[model samples]
Target: MSNSTSETVSFFILGAYLNIGYLRYLYFMITAMLYIVIVVANTSLIVVICVNRSLHEPMYLFLCSLFVNELYGSTGLFPFLLVQILSDIHTVSAPLCFLQIFCLYTYGGVEFSNLAVMSYDRYLAICCPLQYNTRMTSHKALIFIILVWLYCFVKFLIPLSLNIRLTLCGNTINGLYCSNYLVVKLACSDTQVNNIYGVFATALSILVTVLPILFSYMRILRVCFSGSKQTRQKAVSTCTPHLVSLLNFSFGCSFEILQSRFDMSGVPCVLRIILSLYFLIIQPLMNPVMYGLQMSKLRNICKHVLCYKLLAGGRNTVTESCEI
Candidate 1:
């Protein structure tokens, strides 16, 4: 009975964040379903990569990294969202808010690095066949992933650790979750230093990810188009999805950054949801399906799972027939 009353209060409080009018309840329920699917799909991909030796290449290696990031990333987000959806007076402590911003930036920056690295790997394999193996050696791969994580860690902690320590004036966080910018807006102290440094860090991350990517694709396009027949087809199949993901994330992210100049505070709640989904909803969900598990190797692994299940079923059927 107490649980029921608590749930009712939660629902009421969470409703304040949604203005769906006649369909508010439906919209909230659908969002919940989307979160569940994201968890299942990404987790499935992570498990497959871990248990399957065949997916140990640098590409899948980076993908597995992404899967892990997505896992924790969802944890940092969805639980709060779930609780918010269930109960009202959704408030977070300042330290917790800072932690949320730090995690979000950390994961997001790491993802940028991961995707960029993956893109560069593909570029080398396609454009420079002879040097691909040498270029993307195990040592090199380890160093690269490590550096990406280090870079993101520094970027995330520096801003948040400093900013969150400052006294906060306005305490209300507009978005459902704590975001870096949102927290900065709450600072009782002037946030200009934080904002400047934060923007610098962000620009550095983007440039690090984008410049090499641009060069890689340029060279890749030149090499692929220079050849003909099967090679061209291979290149398109290999790179098209990467291209789609880059466009999706980069476009939204760039727009998001640009909008910050005008104070992202003014942006409507709905638009914020859309932008958040660009990374959380759109990319993570599509990546396992389009990038990771859709590969021929992953497909074969799926076949293996299915075959094992069928064989088990067949044995059960035969045993039952004999008993009969």
Candidate 2:
């Protein structure tokens, strides 16, 4: 075996610090709080959809899937990030590095795929309301969701396989987390194959996930333009959240991809860190809030649940006092 291949080297993640010392506690507390908010927001939406039988329909089911994807993406990043922010040294073992790469990539892929599927769901509902119920059955929706996740997971594995074999001489990852391109760039040997596969995978994933969203929205737009006033209002109400989510996610992904590929040496480290961590930090918190506040049914259900919890807490407090 090659010496570089066999030799163990610790990877220092130099992206977390801002050169001014003592911000670790500040960063740690802020990140921890953000993580908690993400967990709470996404979980609340998921639980609301799952518990409410009325939300068992295809649209809500797809929404539940999206919330789950947000949670997956956040968990892949925030916990490790919280720890790194608190620790004096930011380092990661090779295996854990690779695992994070897989997770974050999968999270990104599944996110786009879920949004695309949700777009399709919206298209069917608005464009073909009569056929929607028959075509978008629970079984079929489940199948589509499974296929989106499976396809993304399997496709990402190929690039990961190529990455794992390269002999890396360097151990410094430039960004906050284990980015696929950054990891591949650290190789001691030529990474032409990895680079090629990485581009191909990125293009294919974008094509498959984004194209559908665009197509679905275009069709919906056409239908809405031709339909009645009520139809237009309904379409706007239903589609607004999905469109907002798409825009947010796309913006974050674009910044991260650009950060990974381009020369960012001139950019401020603090700005770079924000761009790199944008999707991980913002999108998870954004999606649930967007949907919860915009979608009337979901908002009502969440309010109802919160009120019930408050009343239950009050009853428990009274019972405890009586027992005392």
Highest TM-score scorer? 2
- lDDT by residue (tens digit), candidate 1, 177-210: 7666755655556777787886798688669997
Specify the poorest-scoring 10-residue window by lDDT in model 2: 1-10
Weakest 10 consecutive residues of candidate 1 by summed lDDT: 6-15
TM-score, model 2 to reference:
0.93
The local distance difference test score of each candidate is: 0.71, 0.85
Expressed as tens digits, the lDDT of each residue in 113-219 for candidate 2 is 98999999999999999999898998888888899899989998998888888777767777778888887776777888887886788699769987898899899
- Reference-based lDDT, residue 13, model 1: 16
List runs of model 1 lying over 4 Å from the truth. Answer: 1-16, 19-29, 255-272, 292-294, 313-324
TM-score, one value per model: 0.84, 0.93
lDDT at position 92, candidate 2: 84
* Clashes within 3 Å, all models in order: 4, 0
